[model samples]
Target: MGLHVFGHDPSGDTALSERALIEAVDVLIFCAPIRQTPAVISHYVAQAAGIEREQLWLDITSIKAVPVAVMLTSQAEVVGLHPMSAAPKAATLRGRSMVVCEARLDKWRPWLEDFLAATEADCVRADAEQHDRIMALVQGMVHATHMAQGAVLRELAPAVGDLDGIRPFSSVGYELDVAVTRRILASNPAIYQDIQFENPHVAPMLERLAAHLDTLRDLVRQGDDEARDRMRETLLEQSRAYVGEQAIAEGSYAFERLGYLLADLHEPRYISVFLPVDRPGSLRALLSVFEQRGINLDSIHSSRSADGDLLFRIGVSRDGDTLALRSAMSAIEAEGIGRVVDAPG
Candidate 1:
């Protein structure tokens, strides 16, 4: 744990011999831009480059098959790591998903497993090929569909209404879809660009998605009972049959839970607080202030602010007296439990 870590730019020269410096380290992790990733690892971590058998080479990239394959060409113990979420405000990947592809691990397997366990992530083991294929569905198809939805909304905004104007008339499903679409549109384009193009499996997945959409469109255009029966048979019956009972039940339950959370978040009355301490009972102590004041809370959620502070956002019921809620917030700050921040809109 006390080991000093150094960052070296592979393209740039060091004053001392570059090969000497590289050969000195026990681990070499590749974190360059996506397209140049394979070339960088392949160049530096090769068996001919004096990389030792005990050395570990890891890469934290989205796609795995190619990079892990290239890494295996090295004599070093090779591993491919993919954290399945964006860089979080919190330090560790606790409660999030991570993919671990152990291509050629032998000497460093125990150490790698320990390091991953310390991160508290929900780790899934996959071979490189399987990882790429599943990710094509989990990431690629999901992003593509939402991007398409965003485009359709943009195209119709002039004829229908803009996001803000349409909000008043939106149903739960529409609102949820719009939130996801807007989130994808708001983020950097390059991440999505690579997910869509870099993975070989994504193109085929998109074709399948397009085929289904096209069939739905045709069925709708027919506008008859026969068309309705066909739609039910192809879309609902086949999908439900293939998806199985348990998964369908869980997915439907998840949707209902999301719907409830969304409704509470949209409520007008809310208070956002940040607890400075990082220990047990911090949240409970903060909640007690509201309990003592007899204010009814609709919902409570934890999220990270733009400035990277963890915020506990409380949605208040409409019946909650504003003055009483304000009094409780002031008490919380005065007692050094937490600080009240401006509630998100």
Candidate 2:
């Protein structure tokens, strides 16, 4: 049976078809594949022919201004919500910010408040124009910039042994770029494309930046110090204008918070071997042995090493000594399971 937690809708009511959605729903939430379609509102309106003005209409589009404009004439109290969590494969409402923009927010304010609070979300109230303008930079421009970097790297990677003398050094800026690139390469590309096309302002900004980057690259190749200096100063000035020193300080605070969280969940240390096994079911057999012996594990990380061995770190359970754990592992024929050595010390 279908349940209605908030409203008085009957349980076991058959699901409404698309044609009947507008009439059936007390509130209509429209989520599109992309945020910036001009036809989105008209489409919703037509689908919802008999929907009353008293019914709540909402869209969770990233850029809100266009949706708000379309819904303004309708009798329905319209609101736009943007959830600010970094998208996981399947993200739920938890730990996400839902920014809301409303015309006549008072009418649906209670329902909105109740819905968001249930999910433990932070709610920021803003209007259509303000929301879109912020997103133009936040999603659209940011994605475009990273895409450009990825493109450049793909095009300009050096051949193996080409940089034998070049030392690898790390800096905050490089670390930031690493994080940015990691996100870009790992995520879906369509999301980036949607951000570009959805927001009207994104394309032009990306184009101008791309042009400037090309010019800068040319200047560097030509050994033009004057051009390079000017470009650097302009870029630095823009960065400062966008996010000041205080913003960096705030980021540091967030980093420390993450460190504290890690410490709170920290476990005792032990190690595991990640070598390849000729026999299947080796990992299971080894783990079973530990289980049978009542030897617990702490934290474990496993990855492939450069030499083609599986590398693993298994932290010892707080209650067990290393010797007992090693003995359990030995009974499983740890070496035959491709472990190089038992309890490397």
Backbone clash tally for model 1? 0
Model 2 ranges off by over 4 Å: 1-15, 35-40, 86-94, 161-179, 185-188, 211-215, 222-232, 252-345
TM-score for each model: 0.92, 0.63
Report model 1's TM-score to 2 decimal places.
Answer: 0.92
Question: Over the stretch 1-345, how does candidate 1's per-residue lDDT look in tens digits?
Answer: 456676777567465454665666788788866677888877776533654567888999999999998888878888999998888778779989999998988879888888898888999999999999999999999999999988888898767657777888888889888888888888888889988888999999999999999999999999999999999999999989999999999999999998898888877789889988767999889889989999988889998776677798898878878888889988989999989986533
For model 2, the run of ten residues with the poorest summed lDDT = 1-10
C-alpha lDDT score of every prediction, in listed order: 0.85, 0.66
Candidate 2 achieves a global lDDT of 0.66
**Candidate 1 stretches greater than 4 Å from native:** 1-3, 9-21, 46-48, 343-345
Alpha carbon deviation, residue 33, candidate 1 (Å)? 2.8
> Candidate 2, residues 104-159: lDDT per residue as tens digits?
56677798777777656678888778887778778877777777776765665454
* CA-RMSD of model 1: 2.4
CA shift at 209, candidate 1, in angstroms?
A: 1.4
Q: Once model 1 is optimally superposed onto the true structure by TM-score, how far is the C-alpha of residue 87 displaced, in angstroms?
A: 1.1
Q: Per model, how many backbone clashes are there?
A: 0, 4
